[model samples]
Target: MSLAGKVAIVTGSGRGLGLAYAQELAAQGASVIVNDVDAATAAEAVAAIEAAGGTASAVVAPVGPSATAKALVDAAFERYGRLDILVTNAGVLRDTVLWKMSDDDFDTVVDVHLRGTFTCVREAASRMREQGEGGRIICIGSPTGQRGNFGQTNYAAAKAGIVGMVRTWAMELKKAGITANAVIPVAATAMTATVPYFHAAVEAEAKGEAMPAFFRHDLGFGDAGDVAPLIAHLASDAAAGVTGQAIGVGGDRLQLWSHPEPVATAYREGGWDAAALSEEFDAIVGERLQSVGEKFPPLPEELQPPQA
Candidate 1:
């Protein structure tokens, strides 16, 4: 993964997972463009990279806007003469239930995550196409989008939209030699620590308590450094042939996920009327509700049963 001649731009690289990715990419010999909304933070990241014997520069611009995304991409080419990798990792959280969530809260999350990723990817893809060279586009997603969570309807929708974007872009951009992919990362970062349930879940896992199977896949409390390797690999030339994929990176778990499944339906020669449709819906709902009674599989011999 030596990216000696490549130029990588990572948005929101001032801190957290974005910073970690930028640092690791730089360490691997890529000249990095550290973009963040905060000028001081971006400058700090640039200074740190330079101090570590890596080439980097700061670009203080909000990446949520299309104009800002184009400017950021232009700045990278202006400084380094080329852009090889674009990591759309900049995002913000505005968590609230549907009823309590304001228009501003919902709009902010969608604008930052979904629209922002679109802006960056669209701009970078154009440049990559013009240059006639292959490039990588990686969007950061979350488990909340894969499996719904309380107080995160807006966040989940925005994150899930990334998967759709990646899939469509991979198809449209494949001919142009641009690879599009999404990484759903669960790491213990500033965002996760703010949620009490997430914090407790992580503590319970560390204490070796009998936790739910879902919690075993919880990525909310893992080290930020743990996520960079996957991003680096995806950004490298080695992963050129991989596209239109959604990868999950969590503690002791790295897996691929599929989209929602469609239910099977009985079809007739003539389409059913409204009354027949209603009857079918009722039967389907009743069968699904009844299926909840199925018991879990037995645990291994060494493990004791969970106490109620």
Candidate 2:
């Protein structure tokens, strides 16, 4: 969709997936306000967009605080005169098993990913409501958020909370025509590059070689750019009817995730006590218990890293 004359904001757009999202939005003719804590990379992102003949401005600030959120929205209005889309892509990973995860690790991830999405969406939605025009609020999520992941208690919790907020905002902002959705993206970035499972593919990509098809198709892993088109589409007028949904995207995969709902039901006369319910609980509802955590297929021999 062409976003001509539209003004958008992408948080943490300095590099990786955030930068890709900002660039894609600009490429579609949207004037983008790029937010990042690092001034140097933020300027570089703006320069890259301008070099490609797209409109963009940089806002160098951390994304958790209300002040930063306000600054980003203000920049959009001041630089482009209107706000239409917001991509909450700022995040951090302080991964550790539940027992080893420190309070700071938990709070830090929550502050940036969860609280940042909250503050930014709240500000943007408020202005969009006042402007009396429909808008788009796209939040970032992770597969870990949908299903538990090892050593990702903080990241998973924050990302999951973001999706929860998006669902809530979809209902609250419907009357004003503001649509809210979460994008669960998988790609080879600085983050995933550290994962042992992805090392071979990531190394191949760093050497300027194309990633294996297995990564793109089976694992749904590719470059960061692979996930940006979904963001652009969600931001467009065409997606007005698509809200309160968690969408997954990657190399060649596009997924529509199901919301949590009761998969089984049972009735008891006068509400049976705990002992009786415990006896029958598994027999009735446990058969349909859903699996948790992400399931990756077996890796091919050709894609494996060579033995040293």
Candidate with the greatest TM-score versus the true structure: 2
> In model 2, where do residues sit more than 4 Å from their true spots?
none
Any runs in candidate 1 off by more than 4 Å, and if so which? Answer: 198-221, 282-308
C-alpha TM-score for every candidate: 0.85, 0.97
lDDT of 1: 0.82
C-alpha lDDT values of all predictions? 0.82, 0.93
lDDT tens per residue, model 1, 180-291: 9999887767776565545454455457554344444443235556688888889998999999999988655787877656555567568888888887876655555332
Alpha carbon lDDT of residue 132, candidate 2? Answer: 87
lDDT of model 2 at position 216: 89
Clash number for each model: 2, 0
* Model 2 CA lDDT for position 22: 98
Name the Cα RMSD for model 1.
Answer: 5.1
In candidate 1, position 299 carries an lDDT of 41
